[model samples]
Target: MDQETAKKLLVEGGTFVFLGVPQETQFGIDMQCWNTDEDFRGIKMIPPGLHYIHYSAVSKGTGDIAPRSGIMHYFQKKEFLVKMWDKDKDDMSREEVSEESIQRLKDNLYNLDRHLGPYPYEIWLKWKLLTSQITAELAAKLSPESGIIRASVELLSTSDKDRPRGVKSPEGSMDQESADDINTENSNEAGQSTAKRAKRATAQEREDAMLPDLKPAPGTALRFTEIPRDKYPPGSTPEEITKHYLDQSYTLELMIEQQEEPLHIIGELQFSYLCFLIGHSLDAFEHWKELVILLCSCDDAIHKYRSLFFHFIRTIEIQIEEMPEDFLADIVMNKNLVYKKLREFFRTAYMSKVDGRLLTMIERFKENLTEKLQWDFTGLDADEEDERPVVVRLDDDAE
Candidate 1:
């Protein structure tokens, strides 16, 4: 920025004071943090807008940090906020600094100015993709009291009294009676062991029985709603299944609520994408995959939410382009839900007469996938005899 603009921003910008954090801590605003540092305070001249500040305390020996905690804050111009590190409690909490002390710090601002770093203008474009929809209003409506976006894995809690056998006890403790009963009942009447029953719960079972409880738990940083999925009756024909899905998916358009437009779902997508891809959170990733699948599975969805679906495609394209190569490879090689959804989109677009814009966008996305990942989805067959997608490899540059 030019000197004049910098001066104006300095006059109008907010000052965040973080006091007493020891040397070499990992913390900062989104996508930017301290490294090789000592006596960290906080960022200054911050733009008056919605921003997320996160931090983690490093472990003593192993150097493994604790789960990161984050809070979303809106910095009004000239706002001064103070937070102190509770080394004993192991957290950053708001502190009530006396006006005299605050004035002293303000007067000696030159001493602290050396520690302040500029907002990362270079990566703002990319960062905005994940956070642009997060308005101050939305943040205030949903964030925890502290306004921090802490990402942590949540395991479903199961009641020991009702939990089925073969599942480990919640407390990792097994009663002697239960162990004896299991051993006695291990063999069937015909002498075959019932060990086959010990399989881990399936994805569908986990989703059906568990996920609902963990979401929106009192301190959950982001609100992720359950994604809709299509279920077909036993012995239903493919045609009937498709019709049912289309009918069900069409009804989702009515789900928009006050302060939430159709495209606001994109905000949820961005939230889940970050939670999954960057936070390494399975539940968030599950929501992301389901959302994509729900949109792509319905051929008519592209028609109903054309612009939303178009944006969805572009977002995924960017995700695929920017994600680590190894992670993308795992997503494709494992035929995960995301990979399957992309395949399903190609199949749906091929079989139906989708919107021209959507069709072109999907084609371009497919071309990018083919070029970058060697995923060649050239044609699809939804016929009764052969309903699988056809993969035809062409020259690397082929459209």
Candidate 2:
């Protein structure tokens, strides 16, 4: 679909909820039912293309949704659903939104608190009340088995202003556990459906909170000072420069290469090193894979830094896993990237730039697998062990 269609679908099809907060922090967490292009309410279909649900909250003006509280949630279309359904073909199809099928979703959403975790009061109240009414009205618009598409409703919590407008709190007979299955036939509907917009924050507050704080963490050798690329050959693209650095056709040994400016080379090296460093801290395997791809982009084999870089990476990974919990926190918060320790080691080995030694190399990349399996097998035993002393080896207590 075109961008305009995509943007329209986002606002129309997606469910918006707000996480009420006083600050103008525009952050959201979206969850998409990727099995079907349809959403939880089966109200709209999402268009394809790297589809993702945008769960963001817009800040309230001084007196819109709340005096200073912003919108709890922002809505966006679930583009990921198209990809997910493509991958998981056996999953429910959009055509299968019969009464039987919708009942399952209803059961799931109603029991969401039980299935996942407790939801906020506003979400619990709004979804329960609105969906119940919508479900009952199904017979009027469509068959009970026929899928009824309702305009996606924004689920929200009752603000202090909304509370006094004859909104009745759920009666004492309504058990929190049983509240999920509230019968729509007996419920009252909310009136005056409207979207409330939040006010803008002052320029200073916006600048302070919106931009990423890229300061160097304490104890790290690196310092951030944004240097413009005016010094480097201005026309060279980042990708081209990186490729040139790693090109086997080029050799650092060639004396002619020494006359070239250093900024491009330094920039490429720092970029690769940053990727390698971040790979150590990333929890997801996919993220590490992406980092590996980034590292490969800096592959200038003529410089002959392979062995040192590989071993440096190995050491960082091992040391991060080996660090005590307290020390790990310090490394994470202060030393910055866990692999940054390798930078100093790299500097020390700069003279022997072609050194084949790995400073913290593991015998094999077996530690990660073994550690993962140990936790998987230990299950709840792992939680109990948090209070116990950590052993140097998994078999430390074994004969």
Candidate 3:
């Protein structure tokens, strides 16, 4: 931003005052992080917009900390908001402070003025784009009623406890095994002592699984009640399978079949993104992962769900674009796992007989992802004619 614009934003921006947090607690808004001490009590001159505020409580003598928590809020110009941290609970208490207390705090604002710091204007635009569509109402709707997300949280599960990350309910590890380990067996010698049987879901896994995912239950997954497919008798042909697919509903059917409105879907997507990338909530991230995979795997539904896919692409595009510099660094340190999985789905649909509009949108989505992340997917798509089989002459084989 230019100096004039920066100054203007500074003059017009809002503020968030978080009080009572201890001096050494880790706290941040958007992608910025700072240790709270007596010198600073609030963020000032913040661009008036929707932002995800997250924080963690540091432990003494050890790095271990409680699960991180995040909340999305929309700030308006010149707005002032305050929260009183609960030391006992290790969070900002949800109960409202009495009006007398509010007035006392307001009166002391002048005394505390020097502790507030200006917003990092340099990152305003990036943050704006990331949260443009996330509104306070939407956040409220998707968040847990009590306004917290914890490690023990799960989504829409009937179980009594919050499921931990990476463990399926009542099952062993869901981590995928390597291809090289396909046929490997337990390393027990002939008639030698056998190793103890693999344990079932650990106590930790059991606890995590019972934690309900705080998101609105419906948005956890797409709702496609029914999709017709041909069930041919014993000896079905390729033609039969093709016909079965054709018999399914037309474009956007899967999305339209949603029990909830499209707005709910979008809100859920935004919520999941916030949880994973910002809140660092593993369960939310898992849901986000599953949703992305489910959408990408919609090769059979792509044509029948064209509009849905179109909106889905835009939803994911914005989420990717909104990723913070720090978060993106962590996400891609190994590999862009989310992007790679999405690319697989896109490539699969592209290789299939997908709707033209959906295909074009998919390409555009990939282009945006590449541009935003500086990623290279150059070799993913290939010329069909180059890879397809060609008719050969008998004489050519002789040569």
Candidate 4:
């Protein structure tokens, strides 16, 4: 931004007043983060729009960091949003500050200005692109009731009846072979062997103990739209149902209907991506992948929602480019879900009657991915042999 623009934002932009944050706490707004010092107060010159504020409490002694927690706030022009840290809870306070206190702070704004950090303007454009479709209403609707998104959700124990029966042991638990080996190695003499067996028995007992069922703490779960289990429409023929499963246009439609508008699907897509990318929420990442798969599986929607698809292509292109290298490697190794889905989408576009403009945009997107990421988009129109359905022919004369 130019000096004039920066000066304008400094005067007109919203202010976030975070009070009583401890030193070394990870604090961020939008895409930027910093470890705070004693002098740190909050962020200023924040561009007024939808932004995610996230933080993780750092342990004083061990330097261990807790799972990240974030909140999405849509800042109005010149807004002054205030929040305080709770020392006892080691989290942001839920209690509201009194108006008198706010006024007193405002009265001493000049002195406090030195402690505030300006929002990083360089990332504003990219951040805006990432969240362009997300509106205030959509943010409110999808955000948790407590308005906080946590990487590791707080869980509450459930009743005995509600707990699952015969819960499977967690991954990396001791197997029977390992236990047998231990038992054999310890069987030197009767008394020592008996003591070892008893110890093993106690260990087994602890392992066998049923853990209580836990659910997310109230008002802390993201309200993403549930993907429909039934992929096909009601009363469809077997062949149509099979076709619906292949294309998933009906399922995508159902998901869109759950939102206020068709474009809100794109909005939710953007919202989920940001939640995962910034908030570091695995739940949000799952939802983001689900949305991506749903969007890429549609054929009819390509024509009906050309604009949405256009933005989606642009949105995901940036997202893929921005993905962490190691994470991208993992995605590429695991059947390359995004690549396969995009191939399917491209195939559908070629086979179906989609808008020429969309086709052009899709071609460009494919080319960009190929050039930058070295992703092969060759033979997209060809169906995989494994995916093709076998057909059986019956003779009419025999019937």
Candidate 5:
């Protein structure tokens, strides 16, 4: 950046005032991360936009970093955001900062200037491309209620009503009454001894027991729109339903309706990708894959939403290229849903009528992937019986 532009940004860009952060804590904004030193404060001259602030607490004694946690904030021009770290919890403090403190910090900005790092200007264009579609409203709607996205979600035991049906409780000693019910006339002594053993178990032992059926702690899970399980609208004929299942156009329509705008679906796609790539959330990765599959499986949508598909092609091209090599290997080896879905999309596009421009872009995208990642898009429509998708239709008299 030129000096004038840099000076302009220094005046107009947002400021983040992070206080009480410990040394060696992993701190990051967007694509960059750093190990904090004693003099480190926060970021300055941040371009006003939706940015992800993520961190992982490092254990001082063991030097082990905890699971990553992040929050998304839309910074306005010249905005000043402040946060404090909680030493006890090894996380950001929930307590609010008073206005007076904020004003004081603003007044002392120059004295603290040296401690703050400038927003990484070099990566700005790439970051913009990755997050272009995400709006503030979209971010708020998809983010967890607690406003934090965690790589590892905290879990808590729930009441029976809250527990999902058909999921068995973790292995533990049975209650005395239940044990009594299990006792046969000849095994009364064994049942009594089992009950005694159960009684003798320590409270800490019970508390520490594995709970595979536990629920995610409230306000921590992402609020992604649920993809319809039925795939087809109600009252459709068996043939129509089967066609819907095979093409997934109706399913894509339903998903698009859930968003404020058709392109917000793409916004969510970018959001989920960034969440996974930067925030290290597997849940986000799962949502990203589902969105990709849904977008790729559409047939009629290819023509109707040519622009959406165009941006999608570019968006996913960058995402695939940015993916870690080991992770890309795993995707290629395990299921390879992305490859299969793209092939299905290409097959549908060739078999149907789509815009010439879109076709040209798709061809270029295919060639790029083939050249860069060595992905084969040849013979996409080949009739492989074993790999072919099966659609089941219920007869009218099935009931």
Candidate 6:
């Protein structure tokens, strides 16, 4: 898909995944890994911070990706931004990755590939890793039934060279209002030095707030309810189990039908486990591999879930609390076995789809996934919730 389309998918479709919209909800999966001293072995320790992502999928042609024209915002990184897309219908091998395509990805990403002299391919790999991680975290949060992601995405319109050297927050002059309840400003030298004291949410911070509220519980995955004998017959065959499971949701039914739409129909089911996580209170990372297995094993009509497994992994990152960066790196590297199992699940699901609702169900599944992923992380830190963004009250709305 072209970059514009990808961006749209990342935005619109991605929003659905992130926001936790109603049915037609998207589906995604995640796995979290802890980065402790043992996992790192002799390496340096990870800094304390959150690191997770969400991953969601859509048909290649179903979304838009053109560069947008508006305030371009993103988390700043020292490395060159590279935009990778499938052009000329080639695999992602270095040989097939044309210079023009690479340039395009760079240009589309940062908009100034010419200025960036030259960097090793490993940099791109890091970008991919980061992207994969981000996507996976997002997907995991989105895939669950309670995946309440509450974030927004905007396109990067301006060229890198044309962009400002260091963009400032829009309301830099604003300060915390006093008890009198009116607007106030803290002007200092040239409105620059005081910038440090200004507190506006970071993109990551905002995203953190946007995460689904699993209060009383912690993560999005639903806790498994004991399957009564009525739900699944005693000694039911694996095939029967699969079929019975598929019969539960209309989303899954559509996927099995697999109409001629470009999109694939994957099965739809709310993560019962996520509800469990929210109600029972649990960490998102601990059950990473199991979630991955479930997602990778979805029996969609087209059977192309493999292409999007990593995307699912990236989505998972958002639901969990952030981790230290170095620790995240270790988990990514050492968790090779988990991926193998995930791949196997994908194979198994493809083999299991007998009726065909899997493809259509994919859309509904995504719809659901997005709901769990896009959550409002902002909680009443000290008191009850107030509907207005500007103020808080102990009781009664502030008129």
* Weakest lDDT window of 10 consecutive positions for candidate 1: 250-259
TM-score of each: 0.70, 0.19, 0.61, 0.85, 0.85, 0.22
lDDT of 4 by residue, 85-159 (tens): 999988999899899888888899999889999999999999898988999999999999998888888899888
Going through the candidates in the order shown, the clash numbers are 5, 18, 16, 0, 0, 112
Residues 3-23 of candidate 2: C-alpha lDDT, one tens digit per residue: 675456545443221111223
Q: RMSDs, each prediction?
A: 9.7, 30.1, 11.3, 10.5, 8.5, 24.5
Candidate 3 regions off by >4 Å? 1-12, 61-64, 151-264, 299-311, 314-341, 348-361, 364-399
Model 6 is weakest, by summed lDDT over 10 consecutive residues, at 38-47
lDDT of 5: 0.85
Error of 1 at 279 (Å): 3.7
Candidate 5 TM-score, true structure as reference? 0.85
Candidate 1 whole-model C-alpha lDDT, 0 to 1: 0.67
lDDT for every model? 0.67, 0.30, 0.64, 0.85, 0.85, 0.32
Sorted on TM-score, best first, the list reads 4, 5, 1, 3, 6, 2
Q: Which consecutive 10 residues in model 3 have the weakest lDDT in total?
A: 221-230
- Point out the higher-scoring one by TM-score: 4 or 6: 4
Candidate 4 is scored at a TM of 0.85
Pairwise lDDT winner, candidates 2 and 5: 5
Candidate 5 weakest lDDT stretch, 10 residues? 192-201
Candidate 2 lDDT trough over 10 residues, lowest sum: 65-74
lDDT of 6 by residue, 124-209 (tens): 33233333322223334334344332122222344446544323343344343331123123344455332334446577755744
Candidate 5 residue-wise lDDT at 159:
79
Task: Give candidate 4 regions above 4 Å deviation.
Answer: 163-212, 390-399
- State the lDDT of candidate 5 residue by residue for 20-118, as single tens digits: 999999999999999999998899999989999999999999999999998999999999999999999999988889999999998998898899999
